[model samples]
Structure formats: structure tokens, C-alpha cells
Target chain A: MSVGYVSVQWNRHKRIYDACVAGGIVLYLGVFFAAGKALYTGRNAISGEILAMRALATCAFLMLNVILCIGPLARLDRRFLPLLYNRRHLGVATFLVALAHAAIAIGFYHGFGNVNPFVALLTSNTNFTSLSAFPYQTLGLFALLILFLMAATSHDFWLKNLGAPAWKRLHMLVYIAYGLLVMHVALGILQTQRSPWLASLVGVGVVIVATLHLIAGQRERRHDERGSQLSPRAGEEWVDVGAVDDIADQRGSTVTVGAGERIALFRYNGCVSATTNVCAHQGGPLGEGKIIDGCITCPWHGWQYRPADGRSPPPFAEKIHTYRVRVVGRRIQVDPTPLPPGTAVEPARVEEVQSA
Target chain B: MPGLILLGASIYATVGTLFGAGFVLRGVERVDPAALGAPWTFRILILPGVIALWPLMAWRWWCAPRTRGAA
Candidate 1:
């Protein structure tokens, strides 16, 4: 197997992605229209209709948060990566529905009459005098503002313009929005002490979901750190394998050569290559994914990298740290020094193995 | 409950129209509100405004394909 023999293509599924976004928009608009009608009618009390409307709004927000989280989490698990790749539309749709929720809350409950809608929203039901006069509406307003920013910049154009680091930092505001929303519901709706059971249920649901994410994220971070430490140090000589056939195709076989780092060997064509098993995208075990047409596609997000160079294809354009390799006798050898991206190396030539 | 249901239905309808327009802009099939028994004024007039620029948006997306070597 020769390293130069393999080439990978990186592309997205635009059709399905577009369809998912379109579907989400349809659902969002439907909810927005429903909320609009309620606002126009000037009904403020938490009737069944209003409650139902609020519930729908809550569901939409929850879904949007999930979409937001999926992008990062998918790096850890390819199965989950699809959720991230197509999550923008979901976020935008959620924002639109949330806007409707806010509009109804403001228009029907705090109609612009004697007091400004903003003032009324913050001032309504001051029975809980002990709490800060910092109206619950302020929290909701802030959360809505964050959501607005997130939705506005959900497009790739904004991402490209802002740059990934800046865009990612801006998007992190979702956590702040999430916190504000929790407080908004607690201080405003929950404090009214009406529908305690329903409020408690919502509270519990949010806590459980948040806790699950926190725990999973922490565990993944720890695993990534451990994998990073295990990576080969620079300038170490690789051990040799007898032949390329010694490595499995599209699968990783753990191998340790004398006085060198342990590496995952992959055979594409007749050539043998090595990389740390942990995926750079999110610490997924690279050894688990199959070789497809000369590239190793991450099982999580379909992020494809050439086995020879560990360079992700276009559109993603990320290169993982790669080790050097050599073949001596029937065994394979590797160098611990990680070659920078676009560096050229000698190709491996081995006889192709017959399928079992 | 019925009152609430009616309110919910109405709100859903307005939101649906806006959402539908967004989808239409994305190039999905346009939803016919009349089929859902909505008022013609809402289905035809208000809804179209929400989606007035959608056709152009759809055209843009269709024109610039993101995936390489796509038909």
C-alpha cells in the first residue's frame, strides 16, 4: 500500500441539509402564527391556551439547545456528528418561535398602554417584593437578545466572516441564554406559585438534561487529555512490520515497536500507515472506522482524512498530527515525530491482500 | 380549553405562515394555507408578504451548490 495512492473528498449533504432546515422553518412559522393570534386577542391569564403556547415555546427552545450542543459533541461520536452538521436551521427556527412567544407575552400581557411594554413586563406581579426589582422580563429579554444574535449569525457566511474562533465564542452565549431562561421561568412563572406541578416538571426536565451533558462532556475531555499524552514524542524511530499485509484494511491494529510509541496501524491498498487511535475531531477511536476509497472517514461526522497525510479534505481542511513510518523486513517501523500538514513523505508499496 | 385551543390554533397559524415562508425561501414546496382552511386573506395576502423575497433566496441557494461535483 502506498500513501500517495489514497485521496479523499470532503463534501456536505446539501440537499438533505436544506430539506431539514426547510422542514424546521415550516414548523416554526406555524407556531409563530398561533402565538400571534393569541397576542392580538389581548388575553393575559394563563389559560389552557396560553399554557399550551408556552409549552410549545419551551419545547422549541429545548430542541434548539440540543441542536447547538450537537455540533461539538458529534466530534466525539460520528453517529452524533450528523446532528451538528445540519443544526443551523434548527437554531434559526427555534429563534423564530421564541420570538413569537416573547411577542405574545408582551403584546397580550403588557399591552402598550399606561406603562411601556418593557416596564410592565418587568414590573408585573411585584408580590415577591423580597426579590430584586430586577424584573424577570429583563432576564427573558436578555435571553431573547442572545438567541437573536445566535440566529442571525447561524449562516456559514457569518461564520466565515467572523472566523471560527470568534463565531464559536459568540455562540457560547447560548449558555448565558440558557441560564437566563431558567431564571426567567423560576422567578417569573414559578414565583407566581401557580401550577406548581407543571413548573416543577419543567424544572426537573431541564436539570436532568443539563446534568447529562455536563457529565458526558467532562468524561470526554479527560479521555482526550490522556490520549494526547500517549502520543509519540518527536524524533523517535518507528518499529517495523514484516509486510503491509500485517495491517488490516480500514481497521486499526495496535502495534508497539521496540523503544517507540504505541501506534494504530492502518493498511490502505498495499501500504502500511500509522496514527494515534484517538481522532483529532473529538477523540473518537480512529481505529474503529473503515477505510473508504483511500480515505479514513471518521465514523462520527464523515470527516475524511487521507491515511498517508492525515489531512482532512476540503471544506473541513483540518490535519491531524501524523507519525512517520517505514518497513523493515516483514515488520513495519514508525517515527514519533509528527509531520506538519502538506509535508511530503516516501510512499509505501505492498502487495494487496485478498479478502477473507 | 376550547378557547385556549382556538387561541393556540390561531397563533400556530400565524407562526406557521411565517415559518412556511422561510421554508419557501429555502426552496421547499410552498404550503397552501387554504388547504388548511385558513382565511384567503391570510393564506394569499399576508402569507405572501412574509415570503415575498423567498423565491429569490431559493434561486440563490439553488444556483450556488455547496457540495462539489453535485448535479
Candidate 2:
């Protein structure tokens, strides 16, 4: 029912969202052309050094758009599926532009009355003759070829014909293309410009991407470690820990539920609370994340969940499945049966004892 | 002036085609060339547009319809 409601809301504004995206593209194109014209005025734009730079910029822009579409599409609901449904049109358009960029680059930069455009492209700059000439142009050529393959197979028809796994494996070459592009830009343009600001921008962008991936990777490793520690034991099944007092207030302790699911339990005042240790967003360990005013916040995207009920706060009502926990004498026992939304479960309480 | 105009035309066509194709692929219609309005508008729009397209393409692929009969 909730998913359906969310879907309906998304559908209501679908056209507006689509139109906004379309408008943004038109505006960007207008600027690109105007800039190109302003830069190269009067010369053969199709076959010039300045045009080559423009082409590279175009390829880079298209690639960036492709990257942006991944996150929102992954999370879109049934009503939002239309955004994903027509995504191929966008992919095809990007490819065509990239092709234009590559074509003009080859024709203008390497052709220009030179003998055999392909040969000229390959052998025009042989400054680095050692180590098989390194063939810098070939890197771009292969990248372009890979981009062509990806664009050609962007439609569902090719996806069905080629099979998903094979198609996906082939499409994975985008990363390779990305690396090649970086090398192409670094060697081709950056070396010539030697501008500190440009270098800093490139360096900063790479660093941010690397950092996000590294954090995501660390979260996955922690989940694996927790899983291994909680494998099913004979007859005993659930692991028994000595009193709720063992858990420090405000800090969460990792507990292994049956079937190797790792959960973090936090004790506040006299109330006990629990939630999945792994965050839904990028698997950030909830166990490691700090508690803020009785809510556990995922460090990755700042998604917060009430530890007592495992329900996300208002404006974000997503909920993670919760486990049943009870205190039997000195032993703390947790039930593996998962609770659904709106089901009320009483939190276990520990009696306070004064030390002499 | 004619020489400059010719050079400008060529650059415009080349850059326009590249960016135009990019805009279409990202489903970005109704683009406002004057959004930033002259001066730095070219760098502002084109640079971000170029940087943003790759992730958009990847999003498209991931969100594309799954092949039937495949898990």
C-alpha cells in the first residue's frame, strides 16, 4: 500500500521531471556550439586543433551524464519506472554525439590533406617510439569502439538477443574506456596546458570518487566478518550473552541473530533497542555509526532509523525487518523470527543496580 | 570579419553537434543557452554537461529492462 502511494506521487510529476531533463540538454547544447564558434571563428572547425579539444569535452560530458543516471534509476519505483524505461534513447543520443566528436577529431586533427586518415592518426605523433610507441591514439580508438558497442547494444532488443550476462560483461568496458580517457586527457591536454587550477579540479574529482568507493568497500568487509562470527551452532542455535548490562549505554554492540544475520543492539536508560548492523544504503555498518537522540544514522547517506522499532523517521518511512529480543534471567536471548511493519514488540528492560 | 565568421561557424557546428547529441541522450530537452547568460555560461553549462553524462548512461543501462527467462 505504501509503495503504491509513493508510485502514484512519482507518476503525478513524471512529465515535469522528463521535461526538465530535456530542457537542460537543449540549453547545454546551445552553449557548447556558441562557445565552439567563439573559440575557432573562421577556421575549418571540423579539422582543427581547437575543434579536437571541443570533441574531447563533448565525450567527457556525455560520459558524466551516463554516470549521473545510475543512482536515481536504481531507486525509482514502479511509477518511476518510465524514467528508466525510456533511458535507452538518452544512451543512443550520447553515442551519436561522441561519434561526431571522434569523427571530427580524426578528420580535422589528423586528416587535413595528410596521406590516409587512419595511418596519419596512428603515426602522426611518434615522439614516444620506445615500448611499441605506446600508441596513445589507439587507446582512444579502442575506447570509442567500446562506446560504439555499448550504444549499439543499448536497446532491449540487443539485450535480449545477446543475453544479459554477456551483454553486461561487454558493457563493463566503460570503466576501461574511462581509464583510457583519463590517460588521453592527462597526456594530451593537461601536459600542454600545465594549469594548476585544471590539474587540481581533475585531481579532486578523482579523489572524491575513490573515497566513496573505499568507504563502500570497507562496509562490505565488516558485513562479511560479522556473518562469519554468527554461523549456526548445534542445538544451541542462538548465542547467549550475559546480561543487557554488558552493552554500554549510547554505544551499540554487535549481536548475531540466527541464520547468521548480524544485528546491533543498543541500550539506553532502561530500554533496549535493535536494528540491522548493515545499512541499506551502500551497506554502511549501523553498528559502527553513532546514535543521535535515540536514532541510529547511517554514515553513508545519513538515513536514520529508530533503534527501538527499526522504523525510519518521518519524511522517510522505510523500515528494516526487526528481530524479537527478550531477557531470561541473566541470559539475553533474541528470537530469529522477523517482525513486519506496524507490529508492536515490547523492548526488554534491565533493572538498575547501585554499586557500593 | 568573414574569416572569423567562417571559423566561428565551423566551431559552432562541431561543438553544437557534440553537445546537442549529449543533451538528447540525457533526455534534457528545452535547454536554455541563456540560462547562465553569456560570459561564463559556455564553461558553466558545457563543463558540467560533459562531466555528468557518463553516470547518466550507466544509470540507463542498469535501469534498462531485464531479459526475460534470465534470473
DockQ in order: 0.02, 0.03
Best by TM-score: 1
Encode model 2's per-residue lDDT on A100-131: one tens digit a residue.
66777787767776466666766666666544
Q: Model 1: per-residue lDDT, tens digit, A75-104? A: 445577566555555676677777877887
Model 2: lDDT of residue A245: 72
Q: Evaluated with lDDT, which candidate comes out highest?
A: 1
Off by over 4 Å in 2: A1-22, A32-62, A65-93, A127-135, A158-163, A235-356, B1-71
Q: Which stretches of candidate 1 lie over 4 Å from their true place?
A: A1-53, A68-78, A114-116, A119-129, A132-134, A225-248, A251-267, A272-290, A298-305, A310-322, A326-336, A347-356, B1-71
User: Among all windows of ten consecutive residues in candidate 1 chain A, which has the lowest summed lDDT?
Assistant: A1-10
Candidate 2, DockQ score (0 to 1): 0.03
What's model 1's TM-score? Answer: 0.58
Native-vs-model 1 lDDT? Answer: 0.58
C-alpha lDDT (0 to 100) for residue A150 of candidate 1: 81
